[model samples]
Structures are given as structure tokens and as C-alpha cells.
Target: MPLAVVDAQTLVDSVALGAVYALMAVGIGLVFGVLRLVNFAYGQLVMAGAYTLAFTSHFHPAVSIAACFAVVIALSTAIDLAVFRPLRGQSPAVMLVTTFALAFLLQAVARIVDVRDGTIGEPVRVVGRLNRAVDVAGVNVRQVTILAIVLGVVMLGLLALLLGRTTIGLHMRAAAADFRTARLLGVRSDRVIGFAVFLSAVLAALVAVVLTVRRPLVTPAYGLQETIVVLVGVVVGGLDRLWTATLGGFAIGFATGLINGVLPTDKTIFLPTAVFTLVILVLLLRPGGLFAPRGAATVERV
Candidate 1:
């Protein structure tokens, strides 16, 4: 294959993978920008969504997908209200560890649920994977991938509009810019913050279905990796800038998948390191993120 063709092939695959990551990263980044703390159990949200899909897929697949989305968002909101919200005034370190603990609890729940159900998790087909391919500049690519990319674009656009053009969006922006100012302006900062957390969960839930459809195979162990990717994208993109997070997720997905394909080894390793290394360099050269900073910006670009 020509060098250009080879590179292009890898890129297409990367973007397909990136669409899911972009969804995930934006969620993490959105939470961090709004509430300067990490939600370690965020991955569990995805896992929960997947398992929800797994169980429901047998009955009504469409309903299962909807249930998964609803469950994730509701669970995420519950976490904010029940756990994180109570610890609102705590140190960042405390919040981080709390979120981490939440992750463990979620995983344990998954383990117990799976054991009771007598099943091991794997990718459940969301839509029947089209074996059909459309030739894209000599590469016979799967049609599903193209469709997935289109969906990703649409979601991102909708989210952008939701954030930019809505009253809820205005409240979110006001809080993100300055919580105190937001309160002074009658924004009810606490409620505003709760909304941010709710939105975070909803976005994370959205990623769950997107990913299950894109690559359904997942185990409880997958939660850790998903958490890391979402967090990494948040960090790399500059937490405050939505586009940066989106770009960062897509960039990492592309880089990781591309490297996974090109390496001579039978198994993939070091892609996370390689991706983070690039992010670190970007941070050293341009702190905050590739985009401008907002709020306290705990999401260092590196």
C-alpha cells in the first residue's frame, strides 16, 4: 500500500475509536471544569451502562439502550447528590480519594451482579454490525464506522448548542466562570453546581451507549481503563475548553489505535504512555491546554 494510503487507513480507524473517547473526555472535562474534582467511579457509570445493555439486549435492544443511558445519568446524579455533594467543601485530595472509593464500590457491585446472573460480559451487538463496506479511497471500511463518526459529530454539535444557547447553559457558564459571581447574579450556585454534576453524569451515560455500540466487549476491569481515558482527555484538552477536550479525546484515540496497529508486537503496550508523553509536552509548551484556561483549571494539559 502507498504510504499515504497506509496513514489514511490508520486515521480512519483512529477517528472511529476517537468518537467514543471524545464523548467520554468531554464528560470528564465538563465535570472537572465545573467542579474541580475527579469522579473515579465515572468508569463504573460506563460499566453499569454496558451491563444494563447486556441484560436488556435480550428483551428490547432499543429500550435497553435507553435504559442504559437513563441509568448512567441517574446513577451519576445520585453520586453527586449523595456523596460528592456532601463533601463539597472538602479538599481536592479528599474528593479524589472519595471518587476512587466510589469506583471500587461500583466495581464490587458489578462483580456481585455478574456472579448472581451467571454470565461473563462481552460486547453485545447494539446494531447488527454491517458486514457491508464502502470503499473509501481504496480501503474497504466498515459502514458502521462511518455511521458512528456521523453520530459522534451530531452529538457533539448538539451538546455545543445545548451548552451555548440554553438558559441552563448560561447558568453553567456563569458558575464555571465564577461561582461567587454566579451566586451574586442570582444563579443559585449550589443548584447550578448540581446541574453540572447531573450533566456530567448524563454525558458519561451517553458515552456508555456510544462505546457499547462501537466496541461492546467490556469487563469490570474495563472500568479502570475507561476512567483513565476520560481523565486523560480532560487533562490533555485543557479542562475548561470543551473543544480541547473533544480534540484531545479524538487525538488520543487516533494515536492509540494507530500505534496499536503499526507495532510489530502481537499485543499492544505503551500507547497510554506515548499519548500522555505528548500531552505533557503540550502542557510544558502551552500550559492550561491547547485551549484557553477557565476557572481554577485543575485539568492541567499534561
Candidate 2:
């Protein structure tokens, strides 16, 4: 690649990568806020959404895309009701194991399906009047990555509004604070959980589309990468805070991309590995997160 080309690539990669990270992080963060347990199976939702697109693109691209997301939400909600909700009365440790088990189940199912029907790999591309370029410190940058940044901001802003302003949002916040208290106040805990599950499902859809637009073709094992990145983001951003996670996701993406652009190509893998190690170390030092100010807080019931 030309020198000029490399610069644009860095910017493009940063933004595109960041969007995917944010998508995974946000959903994980929200789910954690509600249940206070990590959904180890969360990656399956993304894989499900992407697979839907792969299967449906030829039959009906638009409809299939919608179906892809719908399926994720539906499947996750099923798990929540059938698996998580009933087990909620149990200890969080048990729920953690349950989610991990669910995750493995999803992975096994995906493998079976993949073996039964080989994927028709396809790249998703959105064509329109392209801005194509803008000078940045004497280098031209592509427009698509900037668009990714914009989309991430818009989506996150909308999510913040929904959680901050909506009635269900209030209930979630209250429940997160104190599940018992919220139930006592007539806030149906199930409904709140359902809503959390619903949003997580939707996140699956949104992430699939955004990711496909950036890099077409989905693979069966894709969810594992997403799960890892989101897990790191949540730890780095501070598990209790949404915005912090968002910021951490983007920051990690940018750092990784920039390093990839600048470092020796052979050694580039170290960027992600190092970033992940740093995130883990930071968490060990500050268990709540880099952004969270206080000690591990047990949110009081309302």
C-alpha cells in the first residue's frame, strides 16, 4: 500500500473496529447492569444474527436481515425465560455456570449447523454517494470510517436516552439498584429482565449489520472474538457504567488500529494481546473499573 493509502487505512480500521467493539460492549454492559451476571453465551447472539444474513441474503436480503436480528432476540429471550429467570432465585455463581453452559450449547449448535449446511460467504456493502476523502494533517482519509464513528455515537446516544428517559428504563435502573425493592414497588422484575433480553437481542441485529457493512461474510466462530472484546471492554470501562464501557471500546479500537498501522506487520498481534492484558491488569488493580471512582459498590435497593 502507498504511504497515503496506509494512513487512510488506519483511520478506517480504527472507526470500523471501534463500532463492533462498542456494539458488543454495550449489550454486555446492559445485560450485566440488569442481571449482575455475565452472559457467557452472549456471543451466540451475534453469530445467530450474522448466520441469518448468510442464509437469507439470496432469498430476501432485507427481510432476511430483519429476521437475522429477530432470531437473536427471540433465542436470547427464550434462554432468559427458560434458563435464567427460573434460576434467578439461585446464587449468582449458579447463574454464571448456567450462562456458560448456554454458551457452549450455542457453540455446539452452530457447529452442527455449519457441518450440515456450509455457509455461503457474502460481503455486505452499502453503496451511495461517497464522500471518499478529506485532508487530515496532510493525508486524505476515507469517509466510511467517519460514518462508523457517527453511527456508534447515534446508536449509543439513543440507547442512553431510552434507558434514561423511558419508564422501562427507570424500572431497570431501579431494579439494578435493588431487585427486591423494585419488585416490592410493583415493578415487575420479569418484565424488566425481558426488556434487557430484548435490547440485547436487538443489539445482536444492529451489530451484525454494522459489522457486515464494514467487513462482509460471517463465520461460525465469530462470536468468540466478539465475546472476548466485549468482556475486555466491560472490565476496562468499569462494569457498572455504560458510557465508560463505550469509551473504553472505542479507545481500545483506536489504539489497536493505530498500532497496527504503525508497528511492524509481523508483530502487530501484540497490540491486541497487550491491550487485553493491560485491561485485565487494570481491573485487578481497580476491580470496579478504570472509570468507576468508588470501591466495589453494592447498589442499594430502592
Candidate 3:
């Protein structure tokens, strides 16, 4: 294929990647809003969902996707019950380190399960049709790419409604603003955090399904790199507000796609270096966040 053709494909791919990363940013930021914890293990939830999809590939696609959601939500709940709940009042550093430990531990567990079949990875063919491309404006665009963009818009829109129009959303916003004050005013912290975890897990499972279509092989380390990049975006966009964090995620993912497409194929190894350099520049210019308000306070707000 011509390099120009590849670059064009990369352009579309970048948009899809940005949409997916924005979803991830919402997942991560939701937890951060309530718990003030980064939850580095967030990627593990996606990995678990991917593994579920892989293991159940023989089932109908709908069933496999449902199972993925079930497994991820269950794991997320378990983590909240065993880890977050117990470590609730701990310092941010302690909670952060615990999430790191949880991430590695989940990865190790995944590796053990993954190798049981004498292979290091599993293929999820349930949604393989998404890998096929369609002609769009004289260009071949993957179905998954279109699906991702549509899904991103729909999910984000629904989320906006949920947060802005629902009672639980109001409570969550209140809790995010000031947990102590919200609690004093009768907001249930545990309920808010649990709901946040549930929503985050749902997004992770959806991401797993989309990702497995992009890369069907499910490995223990699946979603790890994406999580790291999205985290950078969360910080870049401003951790103080959910919308800004999400925008940051999309921006980084979009930039990454462009950079990768522009670089010589063999020199793609420097993609991270280029991406982080951009991040450094952005941070130096606006340490508060690219999308944050001009005089946004340091306090957290969803």
C-alpha cells in the first residue's frame, strides 16, 4: 500500500482511538472524582473483560459481550469491597501504591490463567466481523472505527444525561465537590463510590470489546499501555474536572495516532518519546490543564 493510503487510514484510526481513550478517561476520572485515587489498576478491569470475551468466544457475540460486562463489573465490585473500602481513609499515596500492587497482581493472575491452555494469549472471534472495512468516501474504513466513534458519542451523551438529569448524578456531583460536606448533608459515600465503580467497569468492558476487535489476541497486559496514555491525558486535561480530563484523553490519543502515522514505519519505536515530549510541552504551557478554566480552583469537581 502507498504511504499516503496508510496515512489516510491512520487519520481515521486516530479519531477512533481518541474516542476510545475519551471513554477510558471518563472511567478513570469518575473514580478519581469520588475517591481522589488514581486507580492505576483500572486497566486490569479491561484486561479481565478481554479475557472473558476470549474464553467465551464460542458463545454468541451478544452472550460473550454480556459475560465480559458481568465479569468486569464483578471484579470491579470485588476490588471496591476488598481494597477500596478497607483502604478508604488512607492517604492518597498509600491508596495509589495499593492500586499499583493490584494492577501487577491482576496481571500475574491473568498470566497464570492464560497459560493454562499452553498459550500466552487467546483469540476472541465473536465480534470478528467488526474487523472488516467498508468503503467510505473512496477510502476503506474499518467497521470498528465507525462503531467506536458512534459508541463514544452515544456513551458520552448518555453519561451527560445521567449526571445532569438524575438524582444519583446530583448526589455524585455533590460528593465529588466535597465528600465530607456531602456526607454531612446525607449523601451516602459508599453508594456513590460503588455506583462510580459500576459505571467505570461498564465502560472498561465496552472498551475491551472494541479493543479485541482492533486486536483480537487477548494478553495479560492488554489495555495497560492505553491506560497509561489516557492517564497522562487525564492529568494534561486537568484532573479537577471530568470533562477536561476526557478532552485530554482524546487529544493525546489523537496526537498519538497522527505521530505514529507520520513517522517512518520502522521508526515507530519513538512514538512514546514524541508523545511524552508533546505532553511535557503542554504541561509546561498550562500545568493546570489544557481544557481547564482559566482560574479553576485546585479542589476536585466532577
Candidate 4:
């Protein structure tokens, strides 16, 4: 391919990748903003959604997608009620460890279920047709790429309105700003947290849909690596604010795509090393946050 062509394709792929990462970042950041807890089990939530899609792949695409969403949201809500709710008011460290435990537990359960039929990694082909590329202005773009970009923008806009206009959104914002004060002011913690989890789950399912189009196999740790990267992106962007966190996620993902594009195909194994090296450098330079304004006091507010 010509250098120009390669650059164009890289830009397109970067945008798509960044959009997906931003979605996941927002999901993680939302919960952290409101509850001050980083839910490490979030990848498992996406993993569960991927498996759900795999199991329901024989059905119509719409039906399978709907089932995926249902399973993820239900599982998210259950986790909150059964695990997180009881641990409420606990130290942030305790909650973080609990989430790690929950993540491992879910992954183990997935492995058991997957190996039950003597198959380790079952591939799900839900909406496989979307993987086909269509030419746009002489450039080939996968359908799912377009879908991801559109979905990310639409979801971000809707969420902005929800947080800006709705009563529930106001409560969530208040809770994020200060959980203790919000609770004292009659903002029901349960309802706010539950809604945040629900929204996160919805975003997770959407991510699964987009991801499975690119990677069809539904493995137990399917979403694990991506989650780890996005979490780092969240931190790099500033965990205290949602928009900055989203930007951070997108920035990291875009950089990854660009790096992958430029690297020799046979030596692509260095991608993670390169990415994290940049991350470390960024952190050293801006411990507060890369996207955060210079000299601005850091405040932990959503």
C-alpha cells in the first residue's frame, strides 16, 4: 500500500478503536465517579455479554443482541445488590479488591462453562456480516467500524443530555460530587448506583457487539486485556472527571492504532510495550492527568 493509503486506513481504524475504548472508559468512569469504586469485574461483564451473544447466535441477530443486553444489565444489577451494596461505605481499597475477586470468579465460571463441552474457546458469529468492508471514498471500511463510531457519538450525546436534563442524572451528579452529602440531602444511593451500573452494562453489551464482529471467539478472558488498557487510559485522562476520562481512553486507543499501523507487521508484538512506555512517560510528566489543565488543583469529583 502507498504511504498515504496506509495513513488513511490507520486514521480510520484509530477512530473506530478509540470510539470503542471511549465507550468502555465511560462505563468504568461512571461507576467510579458515583461510587468512588473501580469495578475490576467490568471486563467480566463484557465477557458475559460476549458469551450470551455466542449462546444466542443461532437466533436472529436482533434477538441475540437483545439477549446479550438483557444478560449484561441483569448481571450488573445482581452484582450491585449481592456484592457491592453490602460492601457499601467500605474503604476504596476494600471495594477495589472485592471487584478483583469478582472478576476472577466470573472468569473461572466462564472457563468451566466453556470447557463443559470439551471446547475451550467457542466462537460466536453474531452479525458476522458486519465484518465485511464497504468502500467509502475509495477507502474500505468495515460496517462495524461505522457502527462503532455512530454508536459512540450517539451514546455520548444521549448521556450528556441525561446527566444535564433528567432528575436522575442530577442525583447521579450530586452523588458523584459527594456521596455523603448527596445521601444526606435525600439522594437515594441505591437508585443512583443501580442506574449507573445499568448504564455501564448497556455500554458493555454494545462494546461486545462491536468487538465480536472483529474478534468472533468468545473466550473467558475476552474483554480482560482491553479493560486493563482502558483503565490505564482512564487514569491518564483524569479519573475525577468523565469527559476527560473519555478523552484519555480515546487518546490511548488512537495512539495504539497508529503505532500498530506503522510497525512492521512481523514485529507487532512490541505494541503493548510501546503503548505502556508512552503511558509511563505521560504519567511522569502529568501525575495529576494528561488531559487535565496545567496547575489546576485536582479534585475528585465526577
TM-score of every prediction relative to native: 0.85, 0.84, 0.93, 0.93
- Tens digits of per-residue lDDT, candidate 3, 1-302, equal 34545457888999999999999999999999999999899999999999999999999999999999999999999999999999988988899999999999999999999999898999989899998999999889999999999999999999999999998999999988889999999999999999999999999999999999999999999999989999999988987788999999899889778767776677777767876786777667666687888876574334
Please state every model's RMSD to the true fold in angstroms: 3.5, 4.4, 3.0, 2.8
| Two-way lDDT contest, 1 vs 3, winner | 3
Residue-level lDDT of model 2, residues 39-75, one tens digit each, is 8888888878777776676655568767887898889
Global local distance difference test of model 2: 0.73
Q: Which ten-residue region of model 4 has the weakest summed lDDT?
A: 1-10
Looking at candidate 1, what is the lDDT of residue 4? Answer: 30
| Best-matching candidate per lDDT | 3
Residue pairs clashing in model 2 are: none
Model 4, runs deviating above 4 Å: 1-6, 265-274, 277-285, 297-302
Clashes of each: 2, 0, 0, 0
Ranking by lDDT: 3, 4, 2, 1
Q: Per-residue alpha-carbon lDDT of model 4 for 2-108, expressed as tens digits?
A: 35345677788889999999999999999998888898999999999999999998999999999999999999999998998999889888999999999999999
Record all residue pairs in model 3 with backbone atoms less than 3 Å apart, i.e. clashing: none
Weakest lDDT window of 10 consecutive positions for candidate 1:
293-302
Which ranking of candidates, highest TM-score first? 3, 4, 1, 2
lDDT of each: 0.73, 0.73, 0.91, 0.89
- Model 3: runs farther than 4 Å from truth? 1-8, 266-268, 277-285, 297-302
Instruction: Give the runs in model 1 whose Cα sits over 4 Å from its true position.
Output: 1-7, 117-119, 130-138, 266-268, 276-286, 293-302
Question: Worst 10-residue stretch by lDDT in candidate 2?
Answer: 122-131
